[model samples]
Target chain A: MNTTIRILRYGDYDAMQKAGSNIPATNSSNHATSTAPEWPLWEVFVRSKQGLDHKHVGSLHAADAAMAIENARDVYTRRQEGVSIWVVESKYIHASNPDEADSFYEPASDKVYRHPTFYDLPEAIKHM
Target chain B: MSYQPTVSQLIHLADNALILGHRLSEWCGHGPALEQDIALSNIALDYVGAARNWYQLAANQINSLQDKAAFPLNAQGEATEDTLAYLRDAFDFKNFLLLELPNGDWAVTTLRLLLSASYQQLLLQQLSTNEHADVAAIAAKSLKEVTYHVRWSEDWVKRLGDGTDESHQRLQAAYHELWPYIGEFWENKLALPIDIASMQAQWLAKINQVFEASHLPQGVLPTWHQTGGTEGIHTEHLGYILAEMQFLQRAYPNAEW
Candidate 1:
């Protein structure tokens, strides 16, 4: 027996490059000699309280994961807005390609049968 | 010991917290990284919060003892927390000299905080068990905050000490520069639950643990340790700190936010 796994890639880097986007090249060496280059960006998620799902708050730059979480706490949770925090490297986060948005997501809008709202239910079934 | 700490002793403790908090706040927007900038500022806020508690307690203590001949009154004939913080001169401040030293570099700041936080952790731990109810309560509250401060500084100490040759050297230099002031923290004669010898031993053990983990040298404390901060003697740095911190209050007396 053989097993198969599906892998999806997001953000067309080649197309983005061809379009001459403003995104900085990954390994540029044209920085000033006096100061070190900025650290990588991290996306921050915060859970406002226990039993709540983590929601995307904002992003910050940090040297590493540990620093990223700490930075998230300082920047996002300082106002007691979060009881928990999550940080992901912006580089590691594969965002959906904006150029392919219509092809990828537009078809789902036409699939009206997938909605549970179409089901005929008794008058007492309020939640369904 | 059935000893009760004097209002002066409480004032001294408050002074230490306020001065250190002010120093840490200096790095609010100037931290090497944005994360670090926030972290340091958060720590500064905690210090200020703790100081407010102590100063309030001290002020209450002073007010209660106002009828006593030993208590002295200010020009306005009151000893409020604000008066203690803003109206006091350099010679009257009881903070340790270690805290007043300028924020030299990241390494120096981290090491200094590590040392101060370790001592404060032990001090507050002992105070939390004090016979006095108010002292015990304040210490109990501060202990929670100081515990994180210790961990944060300890992590930075380890990171900088074992990070690289340049970082290691910078940390070592910080340790040397800060070692002398460590003695002043221990020399306080306050009538608290703290055993100077025991606190010293515990502080040294904690420092040694970090040093071992950081692969830094140990047993470098000077034979002749600097003292006199508790006696109201301080370095020139305290003058500058007070000048900036107390400026608004001094300029606009009785000004309310």
Candidate 2:
């Protein structure tokens, strides 16, 4: 199955300032001298229970991975929604270029045989 | 020797948790970051929950004592947990001086939490195995939460102490400011299960390890350490805290959600 992921990119500091987004930069040192020291963004994923795959829940900012994990626990798991948390630096996530979307994903859409629905199962194959 | 916590000792324990939890709750909306805001609030909830448990136990003990003594009832004689918490004045509270101080900055707040949680973890660990069943049970339940609090604060201590020049300086300043209050945790004659002196040593050693890892200097015993919160002598901050915290209960007696 093809899953479409939306990547929300925060604009650069200058652009953000021009856009009137009052978000402060994350770097504490820069905070003294500059108005834009936002901490790096991290994408948060949570596993609701044991044996479940981690699903992307939301995003947050932190100084490091350890901080990010703790932050994710605080923000996402407060209501006991997650048994485990995974946080990745947003910059580290690789994605197929949006400009190549047609060439990259269109071919898969035409390959009907690639899907399980295309196959006819025997009546005796109960599990299948 | 088998140790049984007296009513006063139980009240002291409950008061410390209640006051510190109130201080932490002040950070609910004002944290440096959104995630930290939630984290601090969660910690505040844990502390208040622990306080409620301790207060409930204390109230039970108080009520039983009143029953045995046939004590005359005062105008506000109920010994419920809410009465103990909301009706008590600042002079009646027994939290550590360290916990009552304002949240100065992120560095100050983080370091204060680190120091207090370290002591609480050790104290609770000892209490979890106490001879008193109720004390042991409450300590055991709170130990898990305190353990996480220590871990969370310890990481921030290390991160800030070693992160940047400004961070290091800010953390060092916070240490200097907060170090004097650490003595209040050890000084006192509570006929409790654990030996506080030995616990203080362990607390120092753990603090030293974190300081070494973070490249911050170990705190020296100050010439004059602040004291007396455990004895119901508090800094001026406690009154304000009580005023804010008890406002609802004070305004509407027996008000319930």
Candidate 3:
């Protein structure tokens, strides 16, 4: 009777606790207290300099866009990991739904020209 | 090799690092990020270690002032915990004014850390090869750590200062608030608290280049209303700090874990 399933959108989850190994805490709610309830998870990307693509760094807590930027700089750039940063809220992100994955990504499999396999390569077009 | 450092001088020497380190540690786990928390804490630990060395040295002087014979430092007979415990108390510390202020923000801490590392690197580099083995050993180890801390601070200072409007504002504010304290580093008797006029100038020259690269304005002396920290005077914050830090050591004299 239940043949269908529900799938969550992108940025639905985050890896929050990479905290130190077994560091004792007198209060269990310290981390939770600081993190906002609707505080969107942010995906971090670090670019070492200008005109560069941002590589995924790590996640951190932030209330808004401004705080997000500041938090990213403090967390990822301490080692000068990036000259620029990109923070997209986890909730704002829209990834290909898992239920739609087959239709979304696998449709390209039938399009051979997209893979460059169908193109007839002349001897002069060596690299292509 | 050994050197002659007065008990008062040794206390101040350790005071600079201990107090600054103590202030920096307040950012622990509360830094804008986890990595920053770890990095700042590491620097704090380094200063704490350095302070312990100087305290041990200072304690030796206390031993010498006694009427007892052949007593080890921190082990003088007829000496209550009050003697050594006093040094651990914040009220007794003589750190420079530059170290006692609030940490401001990431940009400010970066600026302060950068300034500290540059001064520390140069001073410690010279000290590592000095005639005093204890000082030299501490300097040698500290120099390695300060080198990276300086690089990290310098790099971020440039990025945050030149970035978008918000970051620029954060950095500029941090700069103005912190710039006044820069002069304390160049003054001979504040930090080194000794004769080092030449070294101060040399450090300034090296530091000037990095500050320029960060696009920060040149350093200036503190405002007329604010310049007592170098000479044993302190802000009201210093006492609170002493109360917390010395609590354990004072409450239980000679207690070592």
Candidate 4:
């Protein structure tokens, strides 16, 4: 299956909430009149100063990507762990079906040539 | 001549952070959302952390003062952070009245943070350049935390003010409820080392921008402003806050973690 990534923006919240098809309304009440609609779930990725890749940290709820980044900072990087943050709507994330694992991954099981064990390197290659 | 911060001045700063931090801690498990709960708690921790720094400096100042009779020192033991925070009576607390009032609702809490954080951001910016190394260092560190706080609170205020009719009304009411106490931020009744009144124009300009963005009403400002928190006079609410906060230590003295 092919996965296409779509960037979510702040203005998209109103449209998503208006559609109200699958998104659940939050039961929490902070406003005086009625319960507020639940914020969209966002998956947070944080890049540490020491590392080059943005690693998956955790998920949080926020109204928009801007708020998601701030929430991620407060929740995930409270100890100064991250130098950069990226937040994507959790709904946009695609995962392979667990039931199809045998069909999807079993083909690679017999491919022994993928391993580099056949290569004979000089003994001087210490780091490798 | 370089300006030296007095013990009262440091205590004033400590009291503001400690009271606001305590108020924010009230929403620890009770925030509207789990993420926001953690966010507010993080902010509370930052305020408490800043308060500890100020109180530590204040303690040192109090201990080293040549004339102990000048300022009213209320701690039973050495003027440690714990003693300054827990041992002081309600009358000794110098936090603004806006901080001690109960966090009414999400709107109230958000607006309060926005207002107070705006003033604190300016105050800390000035103090960060102070001649005193400790004061400057603490203010510089706290300014970073407070800059984020102001941003977070400003975002909420705009969201709530422009959100729904219910949200707009609630935020407007919160503004009205919190308006009078805003003036005390400018009043340096305790004669602190920093010039707070000079920052009033900047604070207003910053808040007015938020107000404009949020579509909150700008007219009908309060004529009479509430003051006296700097002089250690506070509303009845501060007493209750002290009673609850001071309970553990008052019940068992010399207790340590």
Candidate 5:
């Protein structure tokens, strides 16, 4: 589901949009890439309620993760919202190889009996 | 000793929370920085919220069960002397020495905020984990607020305690005037008329940490202000404070905005 991603950019949006296909170079940073670098990246999470795990909420520009969580809480959870939270610097995360996605999990598709739905009995338990 | 809280026992808790909240709210418009102003006022509001919660808690715990809402005077239109007698009973509240003392200066107010928030934070944490469900819920919610309050006040206290010569002198003076009241915050439950006795030893360590970091000689521990704030007794200041706080509520019965 692709929604419109609107952002107020610093430089000439037309030049950036006309010249490139994906995100403009400046969205990644403010200054000329050759000059001083961008602000640190941060990852945000929201714990909807008690006993639930922290789900990846989103990310936005932040100088640090501590400030990021505070900003996220203000921006994301301004309403009476989640009870707990956790945040980490985006750059600190190591990614799993996307090339390995099919190789890693595709083998499990053949094991249909592994699913509990095959032998469902009680009407109360049908949803399982 | 077995737990037993008299009528005044509960009133003491309610009173302390009430007066301190009043004193803190006075700082709403006046603060060192805009950021701090926002932060302090938020803390002030939290105190008021805590005070109201404690008052209601006390009201619930009070032994009198006969027509609590039945009293028409509480809403409006009171008796001449008869109403005054009833008002006397309610106002006869006791609170901590730290809360009752004059908010002497920014230094003193900040100091009081720092120390009081620390102790309150500790107490709230203990209560949040306590066996009593009501106390625990109130404490859990209030603790987060007090933690931030303590953080905000701690920054100010440290800055003042170690800053300019004038600032240091004023800060010390604030402490000296207010130190006597510190005992009230840490007093054992004996005549405290409140159940804070469990925390005397605990709070002392936290206070000592703040003192040690401030690195100032305790010239002389101010003689404790042994009186004021218990047994329905109060300083000259409380009546004025209550008049201001309760004025709108008293005037407008059943009014909600």
Candidate 6:
């Protein structure tokens, strides 16, 4: 039941291999003994008291999820803006490549028919 | 009958909160991490807020009594929270010895908070049902804040105690240092609203449970129990705390923000 969390840098394959492939460090504060590794970054989302969904507040560093939530509470909810919080490890979030934006999204920009604006409206469609 | 006991009880509670809040506030910008730094400050503010409430109540109680000759007063000739807090010397303060001790490290601070918050939770719960309306209301309001303090400290104690060998050792060391002073919480020198001794068993049980969860040692007793902080006899540490905390007020008498 070792609780020592290890952070692996993506490019440091040699060090990762040397440390035995993502296992928990045998000792807590292992980072302290060597070069100090920063705590993992967690993206914080806060549902404001009046909001229906959690909104991205900001990111903070924390050792784990529980710590992340507490950190988020302290950092994001200091003004009582939040009714709830959600935290996800920053590394887990995936985003579309900005470099491929033209090929990925430009094709839909001129396609007016895709927006349903070209369709004729019914006479009884009052809400629309 | 003199309202001496009620005033003393209120002052004792206020002193504990003020001293410990000041201690926690010392970690404002210097915590191990940014998030934790803000967290500690938030908790410190809570304690200070509670201290103000208790001090105001104490001041009111003292003013209601006949012995106005000894207490400090403002221009309007009424005792105030500021006067009680800033004017009193270390010998007049009745805070627990455990609180006035230096915040050694993150482990020590969190562990101490856990222990004190647990005791306060129980004490406040009992006081919330007290005969006095003011006492009950203050206790009820303070209890909510102390509950979160307990949770935050408990989580840290578990993490530090169970996380690494070094962390565990540090926590163990803090436990050894702080254990002796815990006896003063149950000391019955004051005519408090409730039986202080009666809360000891529950407090111990809670401590033992947390210790077990944290992978810390349980059943280890201190060689000797420290006492007398409740009776105005304090450790040398309190004088320094007062000197720093009351410096502005003491230097500039009747200073107003």
Strongest candidate by DockQ: 2
Candidate 1 residues B61-166, lDDT tens each? 7777747334434567767778788888898887888999998888889999999999999999999998888899999999988898888889889988888787
Query: Model 2, B1-257: lDDT tens per residue?
Result: 77768777888888888888899999887777778889999999998999999988877777778372332222467577787888888887878888999988878898999999998999999999988898999999999999989999999899889887888898999998899898877776565667888898889899999999889877665668998887888999999999999999889877768
| Candidate with more favorable, higher lDDT: 4 or 5 | 4
Model 6, B76-121: lDDT tens digits are 8889999899989988899999999999977889999998999999
For candidate 2, what is the DockQ?
0.35
Tens-place lDDT digits, model 3, residues B111-179: 778777777777777778867677678778778777876776776787677666766777788877766
Per-residue lDDT of A33-83 in model 3, one digit per residue for the tens?
A: 432444667888899988778898878666666557766765677676888
Which ten residues in a row are the worst by lDDT in model 3 chain B? B67-76
DockQ per candidate? 0.27, 0.35, 0.08, 0.33, 0.03, 0.32
User: Would you estimate the TM-scores of all the predictions?
Assistant: 0.83, 0.83, 0.60, 0.85, 0.58, 0.84
Model 5 Cα lDDT, one tens digit per residue, A18-69: 8884663443122213221244666778898887788887765554555455
True contacts preserved, each candidate?
Answer: 0.52, 0.67, 0.10, 0.62, 0.00, 0.57
lDDT tens digits, residue span A52-116, model 2 = 89999999988789989999988999898999999999999998899999998898987888779
Error of 4 at B169 (Å): 0.4
Interface RMSD of each: 4.3, 4.0, 5.7, 3.3, 11.0, 3.9
Model 2 interface CAPRI class: acceptable
The TM-score, computed over Cα atoms with residue i paired to residue i, of candidate 6 is 0.84
TM-score (C-alpha) between model 5 and the true structure? 0.58
Ten contiguous residues with the weakest lDDT in model 3 chain A: A12-21
Instruction: Write down the RMSD of all candidates, one decimal each.
Output: 10.5, 8.3, 13.0, 9.3, 11.9, 7.4
Residue-wise C-alpha lDDT for candidate 4, range B23-85, written one tens digit per residue: 999999887777788999999999999999999898888778677544444445356788788
Query: Candidate 5 overall Cα lDDT vs. reference?
Result: 0.62
Arrange candidates by DockQ, highest first: which order? Answer: 2, 4, 6, 1, 3, 5
Off by over 4 Å in 4: A1-37, A116-128, B66-77, B195-198, B219-222
Pairs in clash, predicted candidate 2: A25-A37, A25-A38, A26-A37, A26-A38, A26-A39
Query: Which residue runs of candidate 1 sit more than 4 Å off their true CA positions?
Result: A1-36, A117-128, B1-3, B67-76
